[model samples]
Target: MRRTSSISLTCLVLASATLGPALTAQSAAVTPDMVQTGSDIPAKWEEPHPGYDYEKREVMIPMRDGVKLHTVVIVPKGAKGLPILLERTPYNASGFSTDRPHMRDAVWSAQRDWADDGYIIVTQDIRGKYGSEGDYVMTRPPIGPLNPTKTDDTTDAWDTIDWLVKNIPESNGRVGMIGSSYDGWTVTMALLGPHPALKVAAPESPMIDGWMGDDWFHYGAFRQVNLDYFTEQSSQRAAGSQVPRPGSDDYQDFLDAVSAGHWAEANGFKQLPWWNRLSAHPAYDAFWQLQALDKLVVQKPASIPTVWLQGLWDQEDMYGAVHTWEALKAAGHASNNHLVMGPWYHSQVNRSAETLGPLKWKGDTAADFRRTILIPFFNTYLKDRKAAESLPAALIYNATENHWDKFADWPGVDEKHLTPMYLQSEFGLALNKPQAGEDSYLSDPAKPVPYLAPPVEADGGKRWQTWLVQDQRPVATRTDVLSYQTPVLDRAVSLEGAPFADLFVKTTGTDADFVVKIIDVYPPNDAEQPEMGGYQLPISLDIFRGRYRKSFPNPEAIPAGAVEEYRFRLPTVNYVFKPGHRIMVQIQSSLFPLYDRNPQTYVDNIFFAKPEDFRSATMTVEHNPQAASSVLLPIVSGK
Candidate 1:
């Protein structure tokens, strides 16, 4: 959210967390006597405000190495023995609750529940950026071979907590952490070697592995559509640092530029250190592997309670929370690990989660989560001093059923539930693999398929953010995209767990990128919501860059006109195909601006490929006994 914080600097009190001297008021107005004879400047200038619901202190807490981190501490008036709520964000510390006229107009809506209950709320700028002093490194790797300094996010968090417990007298020495996205990443770092006072953590939509399925890339195709994010984030310390917005559509901008490398350079993205390093390390090498939180956490896991929050349609950082939850369980640290997935796009739980694109939920899911799930979680660990046995291992939102489900353990794939849905001749989808059939489509790089409909807005806009839930009907009619679907079902088909795309294909070009989507086709005559009738809702989708099919680190060219298997897993879902609805599978070579257009022709790097490399390639999908192509679904119980 490009926040609309209206906190006036003049009204806020400035002091250290150790109760430094506070600024009293606005500078004494220039009197007539001072105007006539320039008076000597006062030895001390002060800015202070009194009688607020909470005492605001802006302190610079020192790290072990003597570098100070800027922190904002809010102690409610008369609060005693209250647990501390800490959120450390690269997005400015003070901006969290800036412009509040009263205590009720607190931080973001997500934290309102906690704010209402008494607690000493604390926010801090990580290490660099804003009031904190130090040079900034984007997602700095933990201290080891990657980071040699005595500080990383882990050390900073540990130092910050140690200081707060000792300095803040109102607190009961118990601390809990909460944040989303990169801020959520900091919470992950804190868990690596948690401080004694850090009792609980809730990381929402966290960035686990950038190279796998986070904001940066999906399997190896860089998410060039959000290139502006690199410019804004790495260019400056202040959050929401904006650049010029193009009045034209994002599709046209990317189309003209041809490649992400060119687009970034044209838009002045070269100056940032992170962009340069990211461009250089296009593969999952040491740089990215070093930063993958999932791998790192397994080696040194945390035992304290941590609730992994995920959005069902999170446009950004979707892989993190779910993947972490699974990883923790596999590593045998499952007891303290909990998972909760909501019907939301990136960070939607922080706001109203009533609807996403064409789909509307029965209730306000966000408020419900904050109240029922999040509040109870923090309360149990921070205050109750008891085991969180009441909470289930997983609390997931059934998007199809439109309700929540709590299980003692996460859902698993069973052979009985696994069904192979095949793509056969005549654009048909069936349960059994077909014999000797093939479908061909011409995928032209010049006229790549758009992720969303025409007049697509900038990536910064709402349309781009919520495009995950947009109807898929717009592109189903295109010649480049191949559609295969089962006939309208007379019975409901519920799905759970990850759907695997096993495609056997031969491309005229040596290299290609395949985009697969699993959709739910709405019936024509819907009485409840006529507007949603005939809508094609995408339940699961993802892209796989062909060159990296065999090896993520090493890229190889595909042999022309030879059948090769492209196997990859799509995002898992807990959805149901209603009795009247149809299940569809669409396959195409490109997903346009969302993912960088792959030069069907093989080259050293698609980013630096010449214009001649962008040629039209015909892709033939094979479905026969020898080369079967199908989507493997994990069927949950249904009629």
Candidate 2:
């Protein structure tokens, strides 16, 4: 990877300014109100209110630890006995000004229905950020009852809710919490035995465990570009903080650093405290385990009604939402736990949900979601409304048919009917396993496979939001990548749960990385859309570091030239492989700057490996009756 100079930053800024309105228009055109059978109106369809007749106040709410967190509260003028909707976030809460509250924050725009319903809206800055009095702890771990007075996110949330319900005049004494991404994590933290006032929560795309499959690391493989960019953006805050130096081409910068054998020194990783702490704990040690929300959800089952909203195409924290939902269900909170999954990117539930990349849905998906699903859930629990009684335990949007489906319970492994798609020697996907054969590829670290190409820009660019659903045609031609496709499907195969890949592989080196992508191949002669006739849309993908095959906490080097079995889970997707569309699987060693390259030479800590540690390796994937390499699809029948 290489870094671009300040010039690239200027160009990126100018490009964003020029293209902002056009993109907004395109989204509006694609995502207009489409639901017909409901009296409930979509937020986008509703005419904008002239102004909020509310009394706005900014206050510093003190926690048990004596840290004052900055908070903004908006109450309807002369309104009393209203339910409270709270959102605590690391992102700046001041962005939502009371005078002009029409912002992109989902708590405001996406849930405008709540405002019309007369619930008090509140947003707060978490500790250690702008206007907050305490140091920010990234992904603050929950402090259980074992340690009293030891304040954490859980304690802070309890204190905040405790204070709000007691102190806020004209309060109904009932509260609901909701947030997406980092704020979502805060919502999950509060779910560890929520305060008495807290009745319901919706944590959308929360970060569960960074090391497993959330935002930072993917099964021990570090996500370099995203982590670096996020750290730089968040590290410096507070009034009058010095503006950081601008840099472009984060992909190139990281690649050059790793290539030059000076990863830490080149990128100045030490300066970023979170990165320093993360690098120190490479494996899933106590550092990451403490931050795992699944553990908390299991140990202390959520008593409050909770709705987990997740995007099937969420690039960052898909694992967090799904894993947390599963954990909660396993912990015997099935009746209180519900899930809503849609064809969306991270936080795109607030934006246009009708289309993602080249794929489009039937209706104004986002609008329908807000009007029918989101508002009713919160209203039922927070305000004791009966309208939400009809909501299902699981409301999943099937990308395959572009329709919503209801389930009595989540279709977990027990209910899933799996069909194995085996890899064949002729680069084909077969229902039956091959007798005996193997395919090999030389993975050169110097020329790794790009996750998306013509590479993404350094600064926060549009590709960051759209890349997960982007066409995979760019890397399909690379020799290092192995492609296998099934013949055109006679009928649609619907997948509703998690997908897993089982591979028997042999690497020439002591360690390596395996990347698997499940894709949907479109027909070439489609007259409706010629440009997307042969588009390869990735349904789900994941990376695994070979060293961690045996134990995530204790990784060991692979025995050179020895065959081994490697099984890993890709994020779940609710998609149907429609007729005429082929199901394809791609295997590759490295997905460039997106994930840090596995040096092929096993080192105690990959973060500190020298340039010489990086080496090219020959990798083989065996597909035979004995060592069959197959992708398991959780096919749903009768729908």
- TM-score per candidate, in order? 0.91, 0.87
| Model 2: lowest-lDDT 10 consecutive positions | 238-247
**For model 1, what is the error of residue 56's alpha carbon versus the real structure, in angstroms, after optimal superposition?**
0.9
- Residue-level lDDT of model 1, residues 449-502, one tens digit each, is 998776667773668667887888889999999999999998889787778898
Q: What is the lDDT for 619 in model 1? A: 98
The all-Cα superposition gives candidate 1 an RMSD in Å to the true structure of 11.3
Candidate 2 per-residue lDDT, tens place, 1-639, comes to 335767798899999999999999987774345646666656545334455466667789999878899998878777798889899987788775535544222345655767777788888898887878887767766664323338877888899999899888878899999889988999998988689999989998988888899888899998876654445445566432222323455556667777312554454555766666777888988888877888878888868988888898888787888788887787777888888888899998877677888777888798788777787888887777766457787888888677888888776543336778999978989889787999999998878888767344653367877788888888888889999999999988888788898899999999999999999999986787787889898999999999999999999999989999998888887888889999999999988777888899999988878789889999999999989999988887775
lDDT, candidates in the order shown: 0.85, 0.81
Clashes of each: 8, 8
